[model samples]
Target chain A: NGTLVVAEHTNEKLVPITLNTITAASKLGEVTCLVAGSQCAKVAEEISKVQGVKKILLADNEVYKGFLPESLTPLLVAAQNQFKFTHILAGATAMGKSLIPRVAAKLDVSPVSDIIGINDTDTFVRTIYAGNAIQTVKSKDSVKLITVRGTAFEAAQVEGGSGATEQAPTVDVKNELSEFVSQELTKSDRPELTSARTVVSGGRGMKNGDNFKLLYDLADKMNAAVGASRAAVDAGFVPNDMQVGQTGKIVAPDLYIAVGISGAIQHLAGMKDSKVIVAINKDPEAPIFQVADYGLVADLFKAVPEMTDAMNK
Target chain B: MNPFDEIAVEEAVRMKEKKLATEIVAISCGPQQCQETLRTALAMGVDRAIHVLVDPKDYEGLQPIHVSKIIANAAKEEKADIVLLGKQAIDDDCNQTGQMTAALLDWPQATFASKVEKTNGDLQVIREIDGGLETIKVKVPAVLTADLRLNEPRYATLPNIMKAKKKPLASKKPSDYGVDMTPRQEIVSVEDPPVRQAGQKVENVDDLVGKLKDAGLV
Candidate 1:
């Protein structure tokens, strides 16, 4: 049996989550990753080194750039048809969330999303109600389509594999549906929020956009990514991309430090899966304290600077 | 109503007010209780509502594929020019229905749309993606999933809620749309997620740093 993982990648490098998906895919069967992008040979070469991968199916085409779901959906269906893959998987990031559902629809199969645990070839575990409940589901679809939550799975090694690379069969990737206009990606020196080891987040208590510098200073000291709560984003203290909540990015970093943030249930859903949660809020009764592994009740304006200095020292 | 879906309904109302849309139709696939959500949509100024009624027992079995099919059929029946929906359902968080529906209808889709504007019958949609934002252009007969930043939904006024009672609300079964609601996956069990117990409360930054070192986190 073979499982096909639709690799997530930039033109030059493989997204790290794809490696995590490979780890999840390896649990199923012989892992083959489909790398579809423009000038993506580097990405294919990178996946070839991933430990669990047995083969890399490279599809280099201009249409694959931006990883548009409309174009990629047809390629995935065609690949599944030609290969007869029993399972198709991708990391449950924004790209995967947008593409897999359409592929599942075209294939006339159900798509299971953001699965955390694989019970067997057919059964999987996933969280629902914004992490309030965990459900184990067994798939009956002939071709199982799934999106793996990157945080839930350990990443496969990006080195020490000898997978062969093959040219994927061509498919009609042209679509009259949507055209890409432009993208405004945040160019940050720190790690990505979803993949970071440490994340220091600010909330409404930060008061204004300038006050976010305190959290940023602390984040830089800890080598952590800077994030914000929905309250902070809604209050115009930061952009929506920094938001961590049920509707925003879900993160499960090793250390998630909440500064000046009250943990709303939605906010808790995003970061509660973190390994060690630390809350630095003035209010002791804030919901954030209930989940924190190390809660320090103090003024973040004063405490964050102190913590940054202490960590640096 | 799902919070994102509420934003969808609000966007539809705004589009109608801008004369960009002639009508706004809202659809919900769930148990009978879903009608309450539909009423809310109507109260938010949708022209009408369609409730694809499934029993609670069967509702658990109805996945996004079935919902997409039901929605696709309704879109065809209504001769709709545009389909607006939430990026993900708050209950299941499937985040699939919009894309799947677009595929089934062979229409373009803009999922996780933070901003949508109509220009010469085409929509310029700004989407929320992993790293940041992406803007795209798609013609009508499209599916758009509302993101949180799309708009802050307005509370329905008392008169609007009263008027919503007279709005057209229709109920149909999955079979009516030729959809087989047989579940693809069996739910084995649903349990509470592992609770994280609260740990030591540090008094100061030095204690916090010490705790971090002890945990080998830094």
Candidate 2:
């Protein structure tokens, strides 16, 4: 009868996608957010401020540092066994994608990933076939485990209600199989791509890695996150982490500006949900123009700078 | 084979070539046509193949949980040291089988792996996270799922394809693995996603910016 939201955080601040996941969890029932990390009391405090969360279950330990599936899965299973939660939810980010499946399997339940719409408690709407088709699916598992596509749901407001915090039941935290070595996260001052309000993306047409600076310059004018098409990433023009496509990160910003991207089906699968799409490319017949709200057929080399200057003016 | 799974098989074949391991066994659970996929793996230098045959009707009902259980059973029966899988199946795009199989077997799981190096019987895996790459170390008997950057899958050459026919390929039912191929989720309906109609073709950068400003998107 109750929902459990596994809060994703970095010990310092809560990831914004957790808010969207909370919104989805609130739809099912009262939500209890589980915040597991080393010295993550701040995250639990942050979760308590969000509206609709009924309780905050905080588990502070060292083993959960990396959020490894080996350690985190056991904790989730323990929480479910004690709480008897009807549904367990997480954002469809990397951590959730890697962890929820293990927890679902241990619980002997099937997990549905990247659900977009909730038809009911058991049914959900999701896009398949690279967003070409949308399917509404109904889960028969006793405990529904799901990963919410953050872009599909509006984030639950950070302010409003008060949820009581409680210590989660302790589980065996000894993990010997896996050890966290290190991480090389891109340090960016720009807003994260998935959560940004405006995104400016490039493609293989950018020609080379240095050419991405043009898109970045435009993005700087609008305070937008810079992204790239899979083609751009495959061409070594940018890191794959910046890729926006069916296989990459999905983003639904308020405004999505495509420069030189041809709008492959996979690329559209990621950003087609944006509210305002503007395409700037020399090829008038590129598939990107078909889905764009504003199409500008021009050389991006000149058009991007002009657009940046116009915005500056 | 799914594109990512092809990368997994290719990585395994590369490992064998480096003398990192002894044997490579390819497993697939689907309709009879899955043999074709398993054959592709064999052609890519897999030592053998196992196909858990399910009727097409029953195959559609199988979810990742069931598939993971089936794989876990086979892994146990085969006494495998490790399991490698694709990050996702492109058709269903569940992206859960590897982690779930690891859970079913109570083994360590490293997913979305971009790089894997063997060192002293332990695996150092660099995985693709949302922001960037994260490296971790896991002992043998772990599960690793290959990401797009893992490796380029080799094509099944004509000679290898002919030789793959002679490789050992065994078929078993889901029942043989004690897995229930039950539909945990029912597809209510499937329809085309909402289409975006092409809007105004702007004359220049200013026109486009003006339109966005009017819409309060700027």
Candidate 3:
């Protein structure tokens, strides 16, 4: 049985998530990457070099320009028909999050989402209840559809044996029920939150949006990505994209700095995997201290600036 | 019901108020307790409620596929023009039902909708994507899943609650729609996450910075 790894690529390049998905797919069986987008021949060429990939299914079309699930699902189903793949895998990114469920429903199967570990072909481990509980699930379905959490797996190397690329069978794309309008993205020069090496996060204790500038200043000094607890995002102190918690982005950076966060369990779930955690808050009993490698019970307003100054020196 | 679902209902009510919709029908599939959730939606200005009844034990581990099938049946039976749901249930965090339902129905879906507006018979949905916001336009009779920033739900006042008691609420079993409720996945085990050991506290910024330097993190 072979596995089909659904590849995610912006029109320009393949997203980092595809590499992680490829790594997960390698664990199951022979990896066949499915790259579907307009002007994606170069992307398919790049995927052909991933370490575990044995083949690439290229579907280039103008209709699949946007990462629209409506246009992508039929392509996947058609690909599945041609390949008869036993397992289908994708990264738990936004596009995957939206697309996989629809694909599974169309195939009349259930999907095991955000999987952290692949114990075997049938059994997998995943977090539930906002990471408070872990569940090991076994699928009874013949075709296993899975969305892997990228942070839990290492990325596949780019240099390896060349895989053969083939044209994927095309499906009709004229039945689109929705039209894409516009997008507003946060253009940042910093590293992406999920793949950043160091992350500095603030919480509701930041007081207001203006106070978040302090976090940005510190992040710039350390070359770290800026993050926020759900409380901070909910309070409108920061945009939802910066949120680092159960409902937002999950990250496992080399170093994680939590400032003024009270350490809600949801927030901890997203970053508890960081290599080293440092907590800075006024409250001595904040829950974040429990997980921190180093804890400081000081007013963040003073400590953050002092810490930034010390790091600069 | 989840807070995001409440926001979906609130959006429906706002659409009704603007004369974009004539009536609102809220539906849910769960145990007997779900009837109360549907009643709450009626109290919040929905016209009617449909309870796709199932025993709690029978539906305990049912996956999103089964749930979407039941909802698609309900929507077909009601001839629903649009289906609105929470992007994900806070309990399971599956975030699959709305998209799956749309696919099963062969209709369009716009998930993670932070803002919803009805203009000239089309739904303009601003979605919360991975790194930013994306807006899409879908013809009416589409599926839209509500996100956190959609809108704050209004409280059901005492008078509205009294009025809701007189509204129509219909309950039907999943078998009535020829939907199978068996789970596709089996739970091998559920366990607590590994606990992190408590760490040592430092006196001040200097002590904190010193520990950082010791760890070679600076």
Candidate 4:
């Protein structure tokens, strides 16, 4: 019944959206937070405070800087030998997403991703076809690795848990095939939609690019990411990166703000993952409202500006 | 490729220039039965294909990390400009392989590309974001994993199907590329999703709304 949780460490920029660790910890036994970095003891100290963690194994190494799966996978495989954990869990972010599969590779088991619910410790349920349908799978293997969809669990929950830290021997990383290159991060301070804790999204009813300024202001006030229903993007109210729908991106922010979005099946498929959805539409019965935790039957133009202006006060 | 295809639409959406591959070699990792997907890709548009075969006995519980390693190895060996994959395979529904493969190659990866184009030493990929689209331009020598919207993969016409037989289908094993096929984690079981309680078909939208609101949907 031993479980291991892998953590994403660094600049503290994207730390809050990493629910995959906590989510995985929630479903497994004796969750161990995995860390690989210099000052990793500090990272482990911070992550062990997240609720539900049982242990922290810190493998602080300078070579573990950015991330190369070939190098890191061996370390995780070695952890498996030591912990004999039945489950290995991670967030579905750039790092967690990259690392879990390698753990699976080292273990030779299927890694289930983006699960909506974990049924028992061995069985999990997730959405496929972009949340259109739910598929439940149970792992026959003893050592199952999972990458939690980023939005399912709350992050602030990690602020007060405890973990016992352990040290392991360094793993010999071969396949130093690709040299590390500098990364160019997008400069905007807005939260990334994928891991956003709160999001304000718009659709075609938003009208135009300029109108989106209202959404931006509201999102800005909320300190949230700006996402768009495909309709809003197609209508040119916003850029494509703001898109949230079946073919767009999958988001599960804690509080989802939907304005002027009519909730096309495709659009619903995207933001449906949000924890608490709020819908604002003139129509009393947009399909979006059906999925919303709160529905405001009113025009967004009148509602949004006032909402932002109020938040401004 | 058809102008309305998934990748084509992606290219158009991104506002990037497009070109044919220097030579498109489709890479696939699967059970022996998965060879059909390769034939399908060849019939669709790829110049040739490579099949990294898994031992028939060991194919079950085959993970994407292994597949990504095998494919990335092949792609690296070929010095591929772009490595293309369906966002998630239809069978396992694990979507991490393509992006993880990019990580292994230490190459920039663009996922959910609706369109792909290469021009002027820069590659343009249109990713379908939430409400709108964003066309990102990265320099050439990156990996792009495709979604269903990228291109409507062509069905192998009779002639192409016949020609696919002549096209090279290189077969390699997991060991050839140093992939450990052992399952570190195993599935305890798998079953169907939870069942929705059967409901009476409401006679009207009003009834539907009433029922929905009662369920806390409204």
Task: Give the per-residue lDDT digits (tens) of candidate 1, residues A1-313.
Answer: 5999999988898888998899999999999999999999998998898998999899999988788898888888889889999899999988999999999999999899999999999999998998899999999999899999998899999789989999998997786778888999989898889899999999999999999998888888888999999999988898889999877888999999999999998899899989999999999999899999999999888898898888877
Residue lDDT tens for model 2, A136-161: 89999899999999999999999987
Which rank order by DockQ, best down to worst?
A: 1, 2, 3, 4
Candidate 4, residue B206: lDDT = 42
Q: Give each model's whole-structure lDDT.
A: 0.91, 0.92, 0.89, 0.66
Docking class of 4: incorrect
Q: Model 3: per-residue lDDT, tens digit, B1-218?
A: 78889999998899899887888999888888998998899999999998887877777776778788988988898888888898887767888999999999988899999888877778888998878889888877899998888888999999999999999999888898898888788999999999888688889988888888888887
The 10 consecutive residues of candidate 2 chain A with the worst lDDT sum are A212-221
Candidate 3 docks at the CAPRI level of: high
**Worst ten-residue run, lDDT, model 1 chain B?**
B55-64
Q: Please, what are the lDDT tens digits per residue for candidate 4 over residues A1-313?
A: 5777777766232255454557656666767777776556777778767777777788877667655454577788888887688888877654565467656745656678766678788788777555556766777676888877656655547567876778855678554433233443435678878777788888888878888888888888888888888777666566666778655567877678788888887787777756667777888767787787667777788777767765644
lDDT of 1 at B93: 82
Residue-by-residue lDDT tens digits, candidate 1, B94-162: 899999999999999999999999877789999998888999989788999999889999999999999
Which 10-residue window in model 1 chain A sums to the lowest lDDT?
A: A172-181
lDDT of 3 at A51: 91
- Give the residue spans of candidate 3 off by over 4 A: none
All candidates: interface RMSD: 0.9, 1.0, 1.0, 7.9
lDDT of 3 by residue, A1-313 (tens): 5999999988667899889888998889999999998888999999988899999999988888777898899999998888889899999877888999999999998998999999999999999988989999999998999999999999999997599999998788764587778888889988889988999999988999999888888888888999999899889898888989887888999999999999999899899989999999998889999999889898999989988899888
Model 2: share of true interface contacts reproduced: 0.87
